[model samples]
Target: MSSTTRAARPVPACPIRPGEPCTLCQVDVTGPQDCGLVWLVMGDDELRAGVHRSRLAAPGRR
Candidate 1:
């Protein structure tokens, strides 16, 4: 066991069944603490496939 291995883990494709490839990418973000958050992103066909994390509720900027 190593820090790199512990920090990162492969996320298995969801609903693995029949004949279908999953549209997913996985990366492990970890360090000294748990930062209670997980993200699901939708890609954009415009501008190099930009990524944005959807807000849980009302969006605010400061």
Candidate 2:
């Protein structure tokens, strides 16, 4: 089997916690901040609910 590295998925705009940083980019970001396409729609409850229900339900503990 070829050991091929998979392409990284595009990151959502959701910011890291306060004083928290993005592991991929190492950028210091936080909530209520805009990153990109996904984050842009984060304000919409319906969209958020439909798309991020699972993620919202299962958050990793720091």
| Most lDDT-accurate candidate | 2
Residue 2 Cα positional deviation in candidate 2, in Å, after optimal superposition? 40
Candidate 1 per-residue lDDT over residues 1-62, each given as its tens digit? 65554555643322221122233423453421222222222222332133222222214511
Off by over 4 Å in 2: 1-32, 56-62
Tens-place lDDT digits, model 2, residues 1-62:
78989999654433423233444443444323435544655567876665555555445722
Candidate 2 Cα RMSD (Å): 11.3
Against the true structure, candidate 1 reaches a TM-score of: 0.15
Poorest lDDT segment (10 consecutive residues) of candidate 2: 12-21
Error of 2 at 33 (Å): 3.8
Candidate 1 residue runs with Cα over 4 Å from true position: 1-7, 16-62
Cα-based RMSD of candidate 1: 13.8
